[model samples]
Target: MAKTIAVEYRVHDGPDALAHAAAEHFLEQAQKSVAAKGKARIAVSGGSTPKRTFELLANPKEKFLQAMPWEKLELYFVDERTVPPTDKDSNYRMTREAMLDKVPLKPEQVFRIKGELPPEEAAARYESTLRNQFKLEGAEVPRFDVLALGMGDDGHTASIFPHTAGIHELARLVYANQVPQKDTWRVTLTWPVIIQAGEVFFLIGGKDKADPLHRVLQGQYDPETLPSQLIQPKNGKLLFLLDKDAAALLPAPDASGKGKLEIQR
Candidate 1:
């Protein structure tokens, strides 16, 4: 039986506001995690919205740059394209250009998926890294302090394309997904791993995402067709930060730009 999940979302006026909200959320989660534990482990997905958020976090003018506890944070990627880290399409490259290079975080603190390697090998290596880092004994999964995600126009998230093999992955922490529609391969953290995170949120924007966002949150629960629906965190809550365009099809937000819904997983 599917469980009910209470999803909370905030809609911003525009892209800049959305980015600011995401950056603030990131900092808040990191601080909360650091206060609870000694350090914060967060996994982030790559996209235009996330890139903007990263830049905001790294910008000297922004409070997030100074407020972020870089030394006590361990950053990870939610997925990576099958390209070299230096490639233009690489998520690692985007993050480095946007935030990593400017941040005070050490190299060892960023655990990037080796997208240059063969798809299966890269997934295996990432899984091994997680196991070693989290010190998993049996079937234990790493409970990241925060997991940031992005939704595709097709209702996909974390490289788990609709009707892809990645959607069925339950035991693996990571997966090598072959996306026929894109004619490319990707290494992604599996849904199981994503759902195990302590905090899970999706940062989405753009008018192109309006329909998909509506379907993902308000439509039927068909994960095979809408992979984003598979992301039902074990903690029973999900968060969404959206720009006005993307939130257009969803229920109208209050004057405070906040909205809440209860959906079945």
Candidate 2:
């Protein structure tokens, strides 16, 4: 039987506020993981909104950063574009400039997809790396301590585009997705792996995403047309951390000032 997907939401006044809340949650999860297991395994996605949160985490003078178990945190990418780490469009580059470079995480602690290689080869290699790191078996999934994701305007997340083959992968932990619309190939951790994480967060902002967020949160369960809808964490919490603009189309909040909505599947 499929585990129930219970979703909770928090709507912030704007992107900056949303970023702050996300950073706080991220640090709390990291500290809790490290205290319980001596390590925190995090898989982060690429996007402009995530950059703000990353910056907050990287700021040394910030109170949160002072006590962060930076060395005990292992960072990985949820997906990557088919580009070198130095490319302007590279996810690793964005993350490095935003947080990794500014933090004390060791070089080996940062696991990035070699997007410069063939998509298939990169995906296969990353799967092997993940399996070895987590000691995963044939049918086992590597449960990340925290999975930070961002939604695109089209409602896609982690390189899983709408109507794409990656969205339908049921066995593999990773996939090489061919997105012909943009003439680019993407290496991504498939939903099978993502849905088993310890915690999953969707950092959505801007007015452009309002309609899709509404449809994904308050509409039907259509993963093909709205890939973000596929993010149903089986054994962990699924949180939608949205800015006011992104949450604009969601059902109005009750007297408590939070647009709290629960969805079970």
Q: How high is each candidate's TM-score?
A: 0.99, 0.95
Model 2, stretches more than 4 Å misplaced? 1-4, 254-257
What's every prediction's RMSD, in angstroms?
0.7, 1.6
Q: Which window of ten consecutive residues has the lowest lDDT sum in model 2? A: 256-265
Per-residue lDDT tens digits for candidate 1, residues 1-265, read: 8699999999999999999999999999999999999899999999889999999999999899899989999999999999999999999999999999999999999999999999999999999999999999778989999999999999999999998999998889999999999999999999999999999999999999999999999998898999999999999999999999999999999999999999976
Encode model 2's per-residue lDDT on 1-265: one tens digit a residue.
Answer: 4445666778888878999988998999999999999999999999888999899999977876777889898999999999999998999999999988888889999999999999999999999999999998888889999999988888899999998899889888889999876788999999878888898888889999999998888787888899988888876458888888998888766554366666654
lDDT of all the models against the reference? 0.95, 0.88
In candidate 2, position 202 carries an lDDT of: 89
Against the true structure, candidate 2 reaches a TM-score of 0.95
In the predicted model 1, the residue pairs found to clash are none
- Per TM-score, the best of the predicted structures is 1
- Residue 203 shift from truth in candidate 1, angstroms: 0.3
